[model samples]
Target: MIELKHVNKYYRNDEEELHVLKDINMSVEAGEMIAVMGPSGSGKSTLINTLGFIDTKFDGEYLFEGENLVTSSDDRLSKVRNQIVGFVFQNFSLIENNTVYENVELPLLYNGYGFHETKERVMDALVKVGIADKADKHPKQLSGGQQQRVAIARALINQPSFIIADEPTGALDTHTSTEIMELFRELNRKESATIFLVTHDPEVVPYCDRLISIRDGAIIEDRAVIHE
Candidate 1:
């Protein structure tokens, strides 16, 4: 579903050019949960930005479903980004003023769905994430786990080609984190949701089907995760 070839990213400061991503190449199949593990200053965020279509200032090929987007126009990239990728962040990124229902509905509305047309789609997503009961509540009224569930629901509402989760379980306690990871594992198992999980937590790696380790702006290991 996704491929990156000979990808390299550079940053400029003062009179120096620093290379960040180094010869990054990766391919993702459908319905796979991949854990991207890296520490600080390892170019992990840059890679995620590249894959999620938020960064196009790198040298190389980024092919999503066979179309190369390296040279696409900003408008074209925006369209593709909205239509193909769903992003979940550590902060949940929910609107505190909006009800859970409204928060999840925003994406559909942006995609051209009328308000009346969003109820079913919104409710279904909420239900899938085990948060249908919280639809009427605001973000501040919910616990961290519930809030993340809403975020996951919002991400799923689009049925995009994949979901990019960056530090998805970062804000919760260990128990809540486990619950969220289990939720993700179940989603991947039952609904075939393709997900790219960006986390520095080793505990988060086991829930994913594949493990990708990066350091010094390069992928050092790509392997399947085996539960034992």
Candidate 2:
């Protein structure tokens, strides 16, 4: 569903230019779950941002469903991001004051969905993530795992073709991390959702269909995972 060819990203600091992504070339198919693994400063986040169109100041062809995003206008990119891609950050990125239901409903509201449809989708997403009962709770009232589930629910409310998750379980305990990974696995297996997850945890790698390792701003490994 997505492809990056000869992609290169750089940052400038006063007098020097630092290359963060060096000639990165990658592709993700529909319904495929991919894990991007790398240590800090390895450009994993940069790669994810590039893939999600969050960082557009780069050189290369970013094709999503056959359209080249590199040439797309800001408005078009925003539209595509809102309609086709869903993002889950390590920080949960939820509003502290908003209830879980409102948090999940924000994206639909931004996308201009009507009240009835928004309500239905928000509820369904919460149910899918197994957090329907906490709809009225605020982010602070929930545990780390529950907050992440809410983030996931918000990401899924759009029924996006691609879900870009960055360190989704970074702050959770091992058991909770496993549960979150299982949730992602279920989404990939049953809903046919394409997921691009960026994580440093090896335990989380096995849940993905493919594992991609990056170092020095370039991909060092890309292979399918064999489930035992």
- What CA root-mean-square deviation does each model show from the true structure? 0.9, 1.1
User: Candidate 2: lDDT of 173?
Assistant: 90
Q: Where does the lowest 10-residue lDDT sum fall in candidate 1?
A: 69-78
Error of 2 at 176 (Å): 0.7
Per-residue lDDT value at 154 in model 1: 90
How accurate locally, in lDDT, is each candidate?
A: 0.93, 0.92
Error of 1 at 111 (Å): 0.7
True-structure RMSD for candidate 1 = 0.9
Return model 2's CA RMSD, one decimal: 1.1
What does candidate 1's lDDT look like per residue over 85-193, in tens digits? 9999999999999999999999898888998889998999999999899999999999999999999999998898899999999899999999999999999999999
Q: Give the clash count for each candidate.
A: 0, 0
